[model samples]
Target chain A: SYYEKVGFRGVEEKKSLEILLKENPLDLEKLSTFSQRFPLPSMYRIHVWKVLLGILPPHSDSHALVGGYRKEQYNDILEALHVMRYVNCSTPFTDVCLRMFQLESQVLPRCSETTGPDEENEDFLSIARSMEEIVDDPIDCYWLIKCFVHQFHAKFGDSIPHLPKSLEHYLSQEEPRLLRHLKNTDALAQLPYGLWFRRCFAGCLPESSLCRVWDKVISGSCKVLVFVALEILLSYNNVLLGISRPEGVAKLLCNIPQENTDAIVTKAIDSWHKYCGTPMHAV
Target chain B: FLEDVKCQAKAELQSSDGRYQAQRRITQLLQTELLQLYSRVETEAPAGTASGSPPGGRADSYP
Candidate 1:
């Protein structure tokens, strides 16, 4: 029933439609390159590209565009798309974002045809609409990231002997930076749901660790900010996963056992209340 | 706050040979126990389907 609501009933058809929507009439070279690099059953590259385009400056070059697409953002969009396809039991928005990304990445560089006023307006309006929808919910992005990280740790933990040294260094540095962003009340509160999760959860950490980190962050003095942030994250999770806030959080915290739930919930509430006591709340 | 906890936990986990082994066990135990309690609330929470549809009912869903 829930899956039906998110347009999961005909995933193959939907996916095919996404493929068609992503079909570009120009720049076959870039399109072919994208296809060759990401040989998956789904349009993961397209989704990542959509997020990149959405955030990238309109005038940025290909090198700048790729450079601006942070590893965290790429992983976040990838994970979000994965969850949308498999776990969340929905794929339409993911498909749309993927299409947007694909269009931006593939079409933007080579097209000589100027975007007509109506088309430009439509694109802006679509982006704004998507942003509004994503910002309205929070948990989806968190769950997407949580699931992504969990699966990654499971697949790669202590087994992948040939991991690139660059990746290792990147992980060591980037993971903390992303986590710190999530912990920042002012910063996290400002991000759209998709970007927030991409920036925070799509990295090389144990899902258990991520949840623990999130819990600790939530428990600190900025609880209201964290709670509101978590609320947004959970809302996004619910959308993607076909679960509710508590359900999504429950799943995210699945690695945590029952006895600690009370402690964690109490800590979260206390932190939120404490945060509410601030001058920021008075305004 | 997480960094602080992580630092403390990492330190605690690394303090003793036995504790290091136990850290993995404890974190797992804590996660499982806490999640069971939290799951009950998840079922009742509202679903966050995006508003509006673009023809064939493609609404963005997350989890």
Candidate 2:
């Protein structure tokens, strides 16, 4: 009975997605709008992500060929990197890349043929812990992370494109008092936004809410991240205001328990609608 | 080919049958809660001023 009542909505959403997927030259605009509005059915999420992220082309006919080509390219890159890692330990790659490469080797059965015993990547568990449940297949996860890095410029470092400055801009407009308090206490400067922006809130939010926020990001622009970040700070404004120490503020903001998903994301989406066309092009 | 992929995925979704019943239940429950929250927020908020937070004192009104 509960399933009959609640499952209908998800089923309807799935049907709509199916219709969109069946379109010949798939109407990307409509699909984006669809993804922006409704929850993506779990069954079709990877394919929809592939299409939206341009890993698979828009033309339905090209799906198989392009998917094959991209997977091969991914494997070839891994094999090359595997060789290089052995030859030169100084080769530069992000921790995410090294972790994903090691994870891929473990997951793909054939990888044992080429991939040598990499020093265990214990660091990825801390970084991408949430990804374990959301995406089962490491190959899909690898490509998704690669495309995310390309699309979102998700490099973890001091220089996130539009960071505390854009965050300050939104804060001034939405929560001026909170902004003033953060500045007065020097709390804003200490927030770990680089990690948040770099990973696109992968570990911060639960899988469902993260997926919803990411749907908006994929549909619209990376600017959506700013709105999500702002909404999050605003959500915890009261807690933040009472704290004067930078460490306390940073600690509290970093670990928002995975509750209130709808309210946060809904407000973020509202913010996106209101301010999307403005000059927030720091991406 | 995309159609075929979709068909295969749909079939997989069906084939799981009762195996994924527990996961599906959790997802449905979460989805229902989310829909309820969406409608409540939608009804309370005004027509425009989307950038402004909801009129409530708390930002998210999580309670």
Candidate 3:
């Protein structure tokens, strides 16, 4: 909790965001680049995320209009769910209807007793549970994650093709010997990249660090994510080199130091620039 | 006014598309890099650098 408070930017950072918010036509490119470089204060994150996620339009003037519509839509969806609660779950068509509603609204569908939890449902639940820890309102959390998933699903969807391989590639670039060690010992396959990439390191990294990492993801490319994962592995380079078992390597990666939020992000950014040949925001 | 909103939405979509394209391009590059490294590793004999030595059990003090 203290870490979260400390994670908030200084007065100058807050003032900078406020100034950008006041601009008549928000410069999203500048806003994105700024957000990528600095940790967004808790107060400004929602607005910045909303605009970037396109939940609120880019233009400041249209916020109220679009906000009103989105609120009405959410309320309507809520009302429908309330009515749906009274319906019989045994009806075959009800399941189909619920699925369609989830597809349309992007809201986490109320879990039914009859149906098994699918991967999509589990993913949404994981994200909702994670956001609930950080954000207060269930509604706001729902919309934020919904918009986020919609925006970056291709890059981070359930099956992110070549994610672990790409991580290995970056690792090799940094520490070829470390990568070799991991491969020789068959520890590379033990890495929880599904949790790392698909969940955006939600459970792997500390929540404060996770939020900052997500901020970069929202503002920049998913390429930054690979570097972040690489940074985590490299932090344990020496330790991993000594360990021989795959389970030991995976366990070490699962829990990492929380205080290095700034260092990890800074190093990740440097690594991104080194490999990508451009700053994350530039892409 | 409605057209302006539509245009804004289009621009946002285009920006998002650009990010996705960039992500894909980077993925392809990384794949190529991995392939090159694979070939290099194959050509060079195993260095036997990684040892199965006992760990010191230190987690926090990273180098």
What is the fnat of model 1 with respect to the true interface contacts? Answer: 0.05
lDDT of 1 at B43: 47
Error of 3 at A68 (Å): 2.1
Off by over 4 Å in 3: A1-14, A86-113, A155-159, A257-262, A277-283, B1-63
Q: Positional deviation of A55 in candidate 1, in angstroms?
A: 13
Assign candidate 1 its CAPRI class. incorrect
DockQ of each: 0.03, 0.01, 0.04
Q: What TM-score does each prediction get for chain A alone?
A: 0.19, 0.73, 0.79
Q: Largest lDDT belongs to which candidate?
A: 3
Candidate 3, RMSD to the unseen true structure? 21.1
User: What are the lDDT figures for the candidates, one per model?
Assistant: 0.35, 0.65, 0.67
Candidate 2 residues lying further than 4 Å off, grouped into runs, are: A1-13, A79-132, A154-160, A277-283, B1-63
Q: Where is the poorest 10-residue window by lDDT in model 2 chain B?
A: B14-23
| Per-residue lDDT over A1-283 for candidate 1, one digit per residue giving the tens place of the 0 to 100 score | 8878545534654564355335443233333233222222233433333322233222324435343334444544455333222223344443334333443345422222323444323433333333333332332333232333333334433432332232223323424443343334233223333222222221212333233333232212212223433433332332324433343433443222334333443343444445344222100
Per-residue CA lDDT of candidate 3, range A180-238, in tens? Answer: 99999999988877667777776666676677778877875777778888998888899
Which residues of candidate 1, in runs, are more than 4 Å off?
Answer: A4-13, A16-22, A26-198, A203-228, A232-283, B1-63
Of 1 and 2, the candidate ranking higher by DockQ: 1
TM-score of each: 0.18, 0.61, 0.68
**Rank order by DockQ, top first?**
3, 1, 2
